[model samples]
Target chain A: MKNGIWVSKNGRVSEASGLQPRDALLFAPHGMTSEDLLQEQRSALQQNIKLIRTRLAEATRR
Target chain B: MAKARVFISSVNEDGLKPLRRSVFRVLEGLGHEPLMWEENLGPWPSYQNPVEKCLEAVEQSDLYLLFIGTRGGTFDAAAGVTVTHSEFIRAVDKGKTVLVWADAETKAIFFSGIAWKLDEYIAHTVQESGSYPAPMQALDFLRSCQEAPPHIDPYVWLLLHDIRQRGIYVEDLARGVETDWRGYFSDLLRRGLLLLPLEPTIAENSNRLEEAETSFDLLAALLPQVTLEPPHDWKVWLNTIRERLQGRTIEHRYGRWNRETVGSYEACNAASLYRRDGDSMRFISCCGRASAVRSFALNDQSSYIALTYAMGPRAEQVYYTESGQKFFYCVRSGPFVATFHFPAGSSWDQLRYIRYKDSVVSAIIGPNTRLVKLVRLLLGGMRA
Candidate 1:
């Protein structure tokens, strides 16, 4: 049995699924785990970094 | 004609109340009928199809006014079924006119509820100038509308009117290369194409114009043209040259020939000749060590050369030599043609030979020898 809370579209969280202390959370809204969120954030930051570098290069060229 | 009907859509009632009222007053003042859902809808209407009637009303109206706020909640909940969101969507779908008023500060919050993918639909975001939020600033905005002398920028208004007649992709129009009316209009006119009316505020228009002007000015300065007068039969002469060299190609080269002759050369398997009306003769040659073709124009007994060169390692050189010069000489290292004024009675001995090579490798050639050879090549050519 998966242990984590279930998050609905409206952001309502339900803990119906039961199972252990260290088990991974499952079925949270879009099925995104904490790690997934962190990864997404990391990716967004990297994209922003790339954009900034490109802008800097353009500015220097000018 | 019946006064145009307008429907105002807003997500946050409190934030938009004042705007809603002002909009109503403005429409009424203009002798147009203005309607808002809160004012028009019956109390506690079934949520099942809360937006159905609004969509219907929007369809009947000539224009739809959208007030975008930043917060999400009931607005997002009712998005698919609310009078505001649905009405705007339906109006757009029906090809009705749309005027979007965005509360810049609140836009992020308002849009947060919407899926990020749908954000593109919300274009034309403008910051409100007043100190307060949408509701607080409505009165001032209304007053400004009233006080703003009836003198709308006719050009801007004309664009708006055209937009109404033929819908446009707002995002594309706003982000076009020529942001100002003049440049935008010039581009449109030059292309012989008509664009839909979509007017930015005066400030936005001016800012865009300035940016475009600066960019074009810089480009023009970097590339200056040397003008020449053509012979009376220049065009025919050029055509004859072209006919003679129709099948051959040319190659371009750039390098230092000797100590002082650092420049570029263009050689071709075939050459085309042309004459302009001002008695100018043009020679075009293709196929060389480089990919660029060279064009030589002769006017007033002087020759002007123009060639394109690669910016990187395989760059070309350009040089000029006068007739009777002993050694060929170079003028520049990049892809450019330099014009040489032939000294009185000077012959081909002053002419120079040009070549192309890698910049790093070409640096090894002595400059003095290059210059001497350049003059000699020119003199030799003139004698030949």
Candidate 2:
């Protein structure tokens, strides 16, 4: 929450719950440079993948 | 390289957009986390006071980079000090890397009292003491903060670099002693362990040298007789070593309790291996004691691992336990040792334990130790 990205207690995005698309825009605010946008996009994609993995793990465990 | 979290305290409303932008860009280019009010603290929840949180951030930062301009900012009536002024003072009192970059013109503005305080600090104590680096302008000051001071020993430099990477604040390095590096270094010099020559070229050059080379030099100098490879996973190795000790039932010899032991031997002490400015490591606080133990154990265990790695792992591990007290391990590796000075324990108790362990270890490893029996006993106790 501090960094605009929702984080679990461990300061990481919870893998069991995928992040919403809107939340990924936290790092890519208006007037962001093209380079920053590219970096943010890459970061967002990674976060999405982590979230998906977490969801998969939770589902399997359940 | 560890990126220090730098808290930039400048008057946001002072109409210095270009300066702020350049500073931010420069900091980011140098691989630092620059925190400021505009991008950070505008959305504080109603329940929390933004001013207090801002001060807290200053205390927690590794470097306090203050840019004094014409604006005095708002005065907090309750605190009787300007917000920016208060933040600067807190940074100084807490013994952070207080770097002030005041424009030449800003000296006339006494409304905040920052300019005078900084001037006084530089003129009297800092200059007279001849130990601290005098305050400089923004660009020069920031660059100075980035460079290791000339007096730092090569070994200490490596220790600082490694521990700083782990986000330890310099103030917390020698916990329960001097929270700041200046004080700790002074103590080291007093003890004759660290020497400050007329020109400390070794440390100055050591800073630019490759990491592996610096580490190797430190190891060679400290443990010339013993060539020890750095452990790949230091914590796992320590745990393995601890297990070996436990399996051999070495704890019983030093312990007051019977062999049957219950409850966790979680680390009660959470001292940093090397404290630096603006290094904050957060632990998720759960409700229960067990959870707290896990949190602290992680902190202390990693700290001890880092310490051993930096100092080399020629160590002796001992466990002490009784019926009621928390069971703990004292690991004395190379020149460094860790004791159970838990947050819950009394200050007297912590100091006493540290002194006692230091004495015992110093005695056994004295330069003139001719008694093979004591050496064998200590080594045999460690072998398990």
Candidate 3:
């Protein structure tokens, strides 16, 4: 119901912000300074890798 | 490369006319989507500046193929550039693969110092004389001999400079403009042709001319696709998406798209999710051309609203806006883009809907879109 809530696959609720600024910047549309698109893409990918690691850790740990 | 949506841009209608069709045929034959303004959208809706639509295509395309020649397309005073010029800028900004085919003159202009000299000449004249030289005097000064580059739109050089700055490779059309323009405008009208017909070409230009009808003959090649009405099961379809979103209710604020630009479109009316009213652009051309018979007759191509919602980590929803209706989406799963529309009146809780309309959201869908769902796309009747 609020921002910053995401559900893990196994009926688990996690409270944290949604996509980070690094993630959001990846989708900035055209006509804005797109010269930064490549850099934003790299940042978004790196952030995604970190988030995936956290989620995987939570799922695998006993 | 995988099949891509290619945008062919040119300002010289007559000069590049045949080449446009050939490029269209070749791309279409290769199962790639090729978008051309006149063919894909009927002479841009008069209600909105048509060039705006072209820029949007540049934004959406995976590959942008540009034709640079003597003439520059119509200039938008508000934007301070020609339509073709703006398209190039957008393709560059969007970071798409831009393929430029430059005529000998255009190539020379870009690799040469003409554009810089011209800019400096004008600036220097203004600095010293307190005003620009008369148009003719300025043209005369641009080159040692005024025999060539006759009456060109100065913006052409600027566009070439932009190509250079972006480091995009320029494939020379090498087919230079004929140096026989003692009176070129009269010559085109007297012969009444834009350019000679061509075999399919991505790089093409010609000094020859033909009958005017020759250019439009391929207009028939771009015959409209079959328009479909909305399917009866849209509610069921949308329900499936809402479920797969894993009950993820996207907070409207998470998108990266600046809501400011979305609000800028003439049609966005207070940026309301519900347009204040349907546009006549849906029914007629703003320029009074034969709109009824053109591709816009289906009305789905140009007369809708687009919104993308990225709820969380790869979960995105692309919504379709119809006049005065509540927006609904066509959801994208890994390989499938499931098309669905939220029924117009059903989803609007006035206060919430109004809030959703006003708030800026991030862009969930980036530049790439799969082609499989283009048919059942938001183009189908009512909504997607």
Candidate 4:
């Protein structure tokens, strides 16, 4: 059975082409400061909230 | 059970003697072969440098039991680290399974992990003493320590507390220790007696002196529990308790606790007599002249209280409550302080409570008994 994996960053998605410096910094394993990782997480959460809001608006209009 | 070579590591200081012994006994009871410097290594000068020998022992051992007490321990001047502290570092570096048991009072300081060495630990202590926030953790640790049970060996408990049910076991174990000091040194030492001619280590003589001092202190603490002159308000409190216990039958009797050996003398004390209810269900409270005997009594009392609450009518929460200026508690096989427990399916916070007082009497009475004399001698010697 394939073990389920938790993807914290997009590194697993594109192994052929390495991530950009900014993306690398955002997804750095240990070197990136705690604040940087937290900021990245916060941004991802904000994007999720925006997408959820858009879907809700469309459902309400329909 | 899979066997492991477990090394018990602690400073040979007075305060930690009880804990070190308890841990050693428990490990052996759990079927682990326990090795300790005191038992395994020969006394001072036999090994040119004992600390290196201890480290080599730790390297060979599979499990390390490290007990941290109040004092950092005697300085190892050559290594510039406390002996116990250095042993802990070496044990950790060697990739052994390290189980660190610390006094609740010192847990915070240990948890900080700030001081890698004893000198730093001492400096940290001084700085913490002068500060507010740092000392807060230490104070909390002390308050918690009071609520925790004294670390005692299961075998020791079987001998001292469960003697009625396990008298034969105690006798057998005592017989084994009569000849072998390796397994039972601390138990015999703390009880205010010792069999001489065990090889003397550097710390052995000073440790014996301190144990004597502690015995005097603990005994002095314990004697006041059997009060012919109960505190002025004790009668009032007892009356209240008696009123609470109106339906329950209470009886009293004078008897001798089973004879045990202390320093070649077969010593027995007049057990303080008090029983509640019929023969089938009775609680015995004993008091005696020997301070060590009273400590055994106290141990038995605490264990009995814990067992009582455990057997029938499960308590939602159990704690020691203060009455007549002493600590009283009935708990289930563990240490608990004066706190209320809220159980389910009950309008009330607690179903039943156990009360025993004079908890702090030992802590208070024992130390002060000799500290004054020591202080006076120090002062006089200084002036001279």
- Interface RMSD, all candidates in order, equals 38.2, 30.6, 22.9, 37.7
Superposition TM-score, candidate 2 onto the true structure: 0.27
lDDT of 1 by residue, B1-384 (tens): 455577877665465566677657666665668877667654445664655666777888867766554322243332323335455557766767576655443333223432121111111111123121232133233234432223221122212222323333322212112223234324534542232222124334545655764674464444333222433453343233223221111222211111222333221122122222222323322211222323333222122222212112112222222222211111222222222211111221111111212221132122222232232232223211
Clashing pairs in 4: B249-B277, B272-B286, B272-B287, B326-B358, B327-B358, B328-B356
Ranking by lDDT: 3, 2, 4, 1
lDDT: worst 10-residue window of model 4 chain B: B348-357
Best by lDDT: 3
Off by over 4 Å in 4: A1-62, B44-47, B109-384
Q: How do the residues B69-179 of candidate 4 rate in per-residue lDDT, one tens digit apiece?
A: 545565555654567767766876665656555454344332343112322333355445632223233323333433223442111111122123222121221211222
Write the residue-wise lDDT of candidate 2 on B164-204 in tens digits.
23333332111122224344334534643333331245434
Q: What is the lDDT of residue B363 in candidate 3?
A: 26
Q: Candidate 1's chain A scores what TM-score?
A: 0.50
lDDT of 4 at B161: 20
TM-score for chain B considered on its own, for each of the candidates: 0.29, 0.30, 0.39, 0.29
Find the 10 residues in a row with the least total lDDT in model 4 chain A. Answer: A21-30
